[model samples]
Target: MDIKIYVCHHKEGPFFENEFFKPIQVGRAIAKKQLGGMIGDDTGENISEKNDNWCELTAIYWIWKNTNHDFVGINHYRRYLNFAENSQNSTISLDKNIDFLLYCSQNIVNICRSYDIITSPLCKIHQISSPNNRQTAYENYSFNHFESDMKLVFSIIKEKHPEYYEASQISSGLDICFFGNMMLMRRDIFNKYCNFVFSVLFTLENIIDTSKYDYYQRRVYGFIAERLSNIFVLKQQLLGGDKKAYHAGQISLPTFTRTYDFSELNTKLGFVNHPAQTAIEILHGGTVHLVISFDDAYMLHAIACIMSILDRASVRDALTFHVIHDESLGSPNISIIKRIFINAKIHFYDVRNDRFPGLLPRNRPHISKNTYYRLIMQDYLPREVSRIIYSDLDTIFLDDIIQLWNISMDNAILAGCLDEGGLTQSRKLFGKTHNKNYINAGVLLFDIQAAKAKYGNLRFLYAESLAKHVRNITLQDQDLLNISFVDDIIHLPLRWNVGSRIYGNNELDYAYSEADEKIAAENPAVIHFTGENKPWHADSTHPLKSIYLHYQERASQALQHAQR
Candidate 1:
């Protein structure tokens, strides 16, 4: 059987035209009459005069009223069914002039033979719950009086269609529900669904007071219909006699759009928007995990550090980045990082004062409280992530990080390169009894499971306790870590973390010999900008400062390019 799918559009843009797919301009009546010719006047649908309130469902209603094809489907101008691949992670752009629509046209008959309905992947509603403490899809509608309005919908269903009342209740209580109002089904079934849905919605239009709602919330009927679409399918399944089976499939929700911004998409994805906070995409199938902690002051350097890692690393897509930041770091910066490392998965954790209260003193300008975040990695990071490479923002990767990630800790709980100041400075600050091989906290490879077993939940407490004992320690968190994990520290080769001070100043006592310094200088996997002379500073005198400047310049250029 032949399939007919309408690509519902609002404004003028590039749209597809295959044997099966056609673009239909919706809201034709309310759209400016002068721009009608420009907005495909020849192929427009005549819906209600107030099409803005109905949103895209106006196009779905138009298709139901006009189309006579046996197999009918509805997708948005930006969204489409991802029939090219079976994987949920796969997405396609119809505007890219791809052959995916043609492929769908050829194979949809075979697909529909087995499945009765093809719907988009489930959209999850977060933190909203029913009275019984179960998650529900109802909270998303409760923005103004949307939830109260929905109660009227339930009452109507209970009064008019008593058989579907229970299913409607069950559908509202679900955490995951069908959304976007995008679906594919046989024409007869589509007609039955529309007949029942519009009858109830038309009745609601007479009763619900939408005068107080904003222009966006006035699109209440569309939102209500999306929830009701789930109920209709559930009701069919519950009262199964001749009703067809529902098959959940994937659809490509486009990220690149000319009409809307990422904020709209972010809100649709259920991201909580704090002031200047935005969402980052986390892709599936990550093999390597990395974590970093910084404030807004270090965001540029952190981006450069990540850029250097991506530039030098052989396997980029396998990596996942976990960033811990305070409120100072904005969403635009995170979005910039996402655009640069488009394939890699990036997750952001907002650092709160309550999580680690009293970890830092009140008047410490020399060291930031943000550095202490790495100490509590076990608490924030996902339990499945047992191993993570934590690095400071002032570092650059010269070799593949996958090499350092593969290093074996053996019996040790964590691994790090020895501090440039060595055990003598450690003893001077933390006392001889607390000193061993002092490892720099700038770069650390944590075998988290082993660390948890050895220290239990007392790692953070011990670090806090050690900070109390050593009040004069300059390294702050680093000194606390050395004193805490004194016996379990594993020393890595000098090449893993080569500090700039190791080459410039001979006054400080370094643990490595001249030969080790020469090897690290020649072939370093990571170059650490230790001490006060950072490359970004105008007065920096480090020999390898240009390496950082190169990445910093590239990061700037990438941000500029993305904004365009």
Candidate 2:
């Protein structure tokens, strides 16, 4: 069987290609450069100019009209359908080892022979959102997108393709969905699908006024097509006849990260490229880097936290620990740290405490001046360290830190779990004008390079912002961060950073559904001891304190053996 899987690209970057897997530039009619050795969607009956609104559909359309292959499929430059035996068909993975993740022409042909259509696996809506609301596809779509456009689509589907109207309605009310407009099927089936999807989308294009939509919302057709593809498949399955319309196989879409090599910067020009970054000693592939800051008081807590992470790490997992502190962490403590983490890669950064003098929050003893150390990470971390996971010393790890590291930053400066009390705190500090959902600064994934580019010197930016709202800054750096990078932060699931405050608090400033809190509490990756009740303290009452004590005892035992 002849198969051609067109990998779509908008700009030149790292891409995988083969005889069966070819590269094609989408929206070439409006693009500036013609990437070499690749076909363009602009040729032969195309809507390349509408690529902004249509997205990858421009490439799908180009294949339908231009190609005559037996089996046709489409994939993005970074994302691909994983048919590899090692994939196990359950989890999404990054293509760190290209050979293992990808399949050759003969391999793909052999696999697809058993299936009629291959696409992404089905996703449950409840898992992604609050189960209390029990959001349906239509309700979910309306919440995120323009409701009027979806309503218009319903009318059009009912009038034009009445055969699929019931399937569409059924899909809209169900919690399951097949996302990402990607699939491989027979030529005839492909054409029929293209006909059905494009007919509804082109009609939608004619009726809706996308001129007023924002840059992101303008890609309305692509969003709707994701759902329509689900409906199209459901309609085929529901067909009541002796012959089944189509047999579909759903595969997991594994997104590959663009790997970087900073080993070359180990030469004399180490400080040349990234001026804000510190010296690069040793950075390598498949390593998860974590950065933390604390003073002498929290040294034990930091040790316990680090032990928790190293305790759960797999043998294959390589972890690099970066500790940021001032002269307060004496030479003896540093020596103890070196011995405890002897098997692991670790680095120590010393910054003067006097750097942040009067900027410290008043009447807040629990919040130390060392809390501001995270702000200067862009100026402290190595150039090779583009991304780093930052955590407060008052927390312990329960699951793999690699899971937190692998999350796509999506070009955001930082990603963390939302703080339910953040909005009310921000309103008190910076007035009601600051309304964006606030994230707890306890556990954070920082795209350090992007942060450096966004704010030249983050410490300077914090100091500058602090001068204006000095009196109002009660929560110290947390308040400052929420105000500074308010629009630039992404809110991840609560499971990643489960705070103890969420266990009993009811008057939340921002609403995180009870169902979400319950899920996070049950299976947490990082348990943060927020508020004054710390596990180490005598009066503390946190229920998860026993887990912390378990790690603390082990950490102490490790420290004692290291002293010998």
Candidate 3:
């Protein structure tokens, strides 16, 4: 009726010595009473003997696929079975099974601790007869290095945990096949079939192969058993015994990115250079979707600014907002803006500490790096919409702003603004990085259907391969768009995006200030505050602050009026 299950967390070898054992101890403590409580013992060690009360054995050890001696697997079989067959209590129920978490990444970790990674998890126990740690890099780093490289999953995880870098994904079989084993798994693949080859053979043999139960064998079985036990525990949990799944580590929920379907939680993230062709299709068709992303803290702020400008119409019905905070410093402020939106009817998605962007290599996650570049070329646009306006959240709207929707018919892809107007010398100081002729990625209107009809996935997706192949990649996104449509692009007026440097000057400031005062009378298409200056804070000196504040006041007023 009431039970508690704790999964094992075994850390192995010198690097992680007994790291996993501590949790097991705790599990045993918590799970010691009656037919319940697995304080720390992993259930894979469970062996059911005919019983009157409940369980024959307290735990079960999962026998992984990599038993070198082959004898250890037998020992595992016999120990569980003998315990199951000969237990004193006939009143106990065999109906209960313990859980273990073995297989995949868990398998890899077990192998690493026992001796070598590849052999322990993959190499069949037969061919080598005797396998020692083949993972020794110093003995043969040159010839053996290739094998170590195959551990792509572990490397990425390590990098992801501590804000390190991913080992980089290659296009070979690994790219298309691997879906991250990110979530914790409870039940292993064992339940699909009832027969265990080793389990059957040992029962008939009268004698257990005692020699097979060494340290290596123990380690190997430890991991395999761990996985199976995890699964069993999960089943029990869902079936209604106790809490079986605890995040092996603290986990954060992912931020809501823009998604095409509204019926379910949006899982994928969309990143493009401005609003490509697909964005237009959705808007024109009058379909609704949400795009969620967080590449930079500024980008998050930018989205807030854009929506603030859009808020004048008090139009919260058309869109929902989702954001994941990647950094700690800006989180409080971003949250304040979200609370304001919630009061006005904008849907505020739950943002928690579990998921992150800082963990990603380019500060971009969701899609692989190469795939993002391809988004620029063609056909890479999401098809639901032929095109949509993609504007960096930085810019503000001085006018009604819906006119851009009117421009959606045939995308000339009106785009402009670059490098904070050369105010930040860093882009150029990086030499080749600066060479790409900055086209601020801050604004873009995409024609999705056109791109699909034309080029295919572009130079953008293959930026790296192109960089290695073309020898020029300093501008990254800027370079790809430049080569793709610099000549073809129909330039939007400078008024849409006024650069920071020129706008910063005192003389020009007075002239634009007065001009803006008059322009405020009529709507300007969109006013982009293209740099560090923003209207959200008291310090933001953007010429359009007067306009942004106009909407903020209106949003508040609209909310009060609606309450009445």
Candidate maximizing lDDT: 2
Q: Compared with the true structure, what per-residue lDDT tens digits does model 3 show for residues 328-445?
A: 3254545555554554322222233422212212422322232132233232224454545555455554433343444433455434433433212222222212222334555555
lDDT of 2 by residue, 28-84 (tens): 999999888788999998999989999999999999988899989887775566665
Q: For model 1, how does the per-residue alpha-carbon lDDT over 142-245 read when each residue is reduced to its tens digit? A: 53235777999998899887877888888877787767777888888889888878888888999998897765568889888888888888877565435565
Pairs with backbone N, CA or C atoms under 3 Å apart (clashes), candidate 2: none
Q: Give the TM-score (vs. native) of candidate 2.
A: 0.51
Question: For candidate 3, what is the lDDT?
Answer: 0.32
Sort by lDDT, best first. Answer: 2, 1, 3
Best by TM-score: 2
Worst 10 residues of 3 by lDDT: 117-126
Native-vs-model 1 lDDT? 0.70
Please report, in order, the local distance difference test score of every candidate based on alpha carbons: 0.70, 0.73, 0.32
Query: lDDT of model 1 at residue 492?
Result: 85
| TM-score of every prediction relative to native | 0.48, 0.51, 0.33
For model 1, the run of ten residues with the poorest summed lDDT? 126-135
Higher-TM-score candidate of 2 and 3:
2
From the highest TM-score down, the ranking of the candidates is 2, 1, 3
